[model samples]
Every structure is written in C-alpha cells, then in structure tokens.
Target: MSTSAGQPPYRDAEESVGDLVKHASEQISQLMRQELRLAQAEMRQKGKRFGRGGGLLGGAGVVGFVALLAAVTTAIVALDLVWPLWLSALVVTAALLLLAALLGLVGKKQVGKATPATPEQAIHSIKADVAEIKERARR
Candidate 1:
C-alpha cells in the first residue's frame, strides 16, 4: 500500500504510543546499520592506504640494506687486490654515504605516504549525519 501525504506507513489513530516508539526504534536501528556500513567502507579505504605506505617503507628499507651489502661486498673484493686497508675502508665508507643519501630520500617519500591515516570519508559522513539529525530535531 502507498503512504498517505508522506506520513509514515505505521502512523494511524489505532497505533498506540508504544507502537510509535517501536517504529521510531526500528528506524533508528536501520539508520545505525547504514551508518556503520559507511564507516566500515571508509575505514577499509584508510586501511589500504596505511598498508600501502608500510609496504613502500619496507621496500625502501630493503633497498637501502642491499646497498649496504653491495658496499661491503665491494670492499671485501677489493681486499684481495693490492689495495691498502685504508683505501678499502675509504671505498666502503664512500659507498655507504652515497647509499645513505639516496635511500634516505626514497625512505622519506615512502614514510610521507603513510601519514595521517584518518577516515576522512567516515568523518564527513558522520558530520553530515549529525547535522541532518540536528536540523530535523530543530523542526
């Protein structure tokens, strides 16, 4: 059946105060469920961002580590030659410094991605919901 004049279907003289309260309760419950779903979606998106940021940082750390290994390996290989110990130390130190500078930049970028993992959509949606509720209450 169709609702009359935009009135709720459950409203009628035969319906007691208890019925009205129950109807309101049911509507509130439905609204809460919808809001929860919205929050879940927003949190999921935020979580993905956080995970991606972590993965990028992990990658940066691994690359930096490999660079260190490479520096050490190069130094060790040079040791077998006629190179002096001081020369080998200098080579490894220079390589380490270069790697640190490059990797530091990349790692900073990856860390920047992970910042402020707040659920923006959820916050906006909740704010809207609160505003709407307030507006309706004023009426």
Candidate 2:
C-alpha cells in the first residue's frame, strides 16, 4: 500500500485517519493566517483614505476663509454702485453667508462618506467561512 501524500485524504486508498485529520488542521490554520493578513491590509488601505479625506477638510478650512474675505470685499465694491455703502456691505455679507451654508452642507456630505472605514469585507468573509465550517461539521 502506498502512503504518499499525493493520494487523496480520508480514504483507505490513501492516508490514515490521523494523517488526513492532521492535513485538514494544517490547511485550516494556513487559511486563518491568510484571512488575518487580508483584514490587516484592508484596514490599512481604509485608514489612508480616511486620513486623506480628513486632511482635505482641514485644507478646505484655510481656503474657505480666504474665499469668504475675497467675496465680501468684491461684493461690497460691486454693489455699492446702486446701494448705500453700509447697505451694500450688509447685502454682500448675507449673500456670502448663504453661499457658505450651501458649501458647508456639501462638504459635510463628502467627508461623512469616507469615515468609519472598518474591515467590513473581511468581517463578512470570516462570518461566511465560520458558518460554512459549522454546517459541514454538523453533517
């Protein structure tokens, strides 16, 4: 009788019961290690995306301040043609605030999309694998 590993497992035509069980155990261990590495890599990638999105928000703050100042100055200058000087300033300020509100809502939406970057895919895969193994064991 040939005892070579090339022979299929869990069959009298090949390995003993012990050899088959050991092979299955080793395979399972290797699979788990691979899954863990996948999860780590996924989380690392998500972390980078989150960091980039967050950094963009910070940069947007500085740029937004400059933009506000420019808009106010330009609006007051342009609208002064028809309105009193103080009234022009007030009108420009109100318009600028409304524009800022719109932009703020859009920015908030974009930032919200990139947060809480968990290893969701890996977690789902792990759950599925566990369920399959459990079902097989029951059989």
Candidate 3:
C-alpha cells in the first residue's frame, strides 16, 4: 500500500509488525550507542582533568616542602641569634607542630565536603535520556 507524501512508507500503520519491531530495535540500538559514546567522551575529558590536577598538586607539594624547610631554618637562625640554640630549636618545633595541626583540621573539613566521586554529568544525562524514552514509550 502507498502512503501520503507527508508520511514515510515505513512508518505507515499498515506496516508489518516485524518491520516495525526491527525499526524500533534499530532506533534503540542507535540511541544506546550514542549514549555510550557520550559517556566515554565525558569520562575521557574527566580523566585528563584529573591527571593534570594530580600533577599540579604534586608540584605544589614539592614547592611547599622546600618553602617550609627554608622558613623553618630562618626561624631557627633568627631565634638562635637572641636565644640559646636548643631553646630556638624547641620553639620552632612547637610552632611547626601547631601549624601542622591547623592544616590537618582544615584538610579534614575540606575532605568531609567531598562527594563520592562519580561521573555525575554522564549519569544525569543518561537518566534524562531514559526518562524521555520512557515518556515517549508511554505514548
């Protein structure tokens, strides 16, 4: 049977059930592939960001360690000029301990705020697509 010019022949209500099912299966497969590609691309982008961030943090740690060493040395030397060497060393040690404790507390608080890391954007997109498909299917 022929269909109107505005309608596709394959989409006609009179189309065979097997043809309709096959068409739907193909569409679903295409949608799944698209979603998978999106997720892969998203993950790859996130991986790059994580790699760069880790490298930057590592560099910062080295720089901070060197700076901390110099600062401690300066503190001890400056104190020793006015006080005994042993007392200067003790004071510097106490100050470093206090600074470390403060940093530990702040780091703990920040860590508490961290979410269970996942590909949140990809998950959300996939969920939305599923919801849309479900809504359409309901029709």
lDDT of 1 by residue, 33-137 (tens): 887888888888878877898899899979988997886877767774867777777777887789789978997997798677666777787788778877976
Alpha-carbon local distance difference test for all models = 0.79, 0.84, 0.86
Q: Root-mean-square deviation of each candidate, in angstroms? A: 7.2, 5.4, 4.9
Which of the numbered candidates is closest to the native, going by highest TM-score?
Answer: 3
RMSD of 3: 4.9
Would you give me the overall lDDT of model 2? Answer: 0.84
lDDT of 2 by residue, 1-139 (tens): 5556775544745778788789878978987898899999999997798789889979998998899789789889988999999999999878877988998999899769867667888889889988987897797
Instruction: Report the lDDT of model 1 for residue 89.
Output: 75
lDDT per residue, candidate 3, 51-95, as tens digits? 898899999999999999999999999999999999999999999
| TM-scores, each model vs. reference | 0.52, 0.67, 0.77
As a TM-score, model 3 comes out at 0.77
Q: Which has the better lDDT: candidate 1, or candidate 3?
A: 3
- Steric clash pairs (candidate 2): none
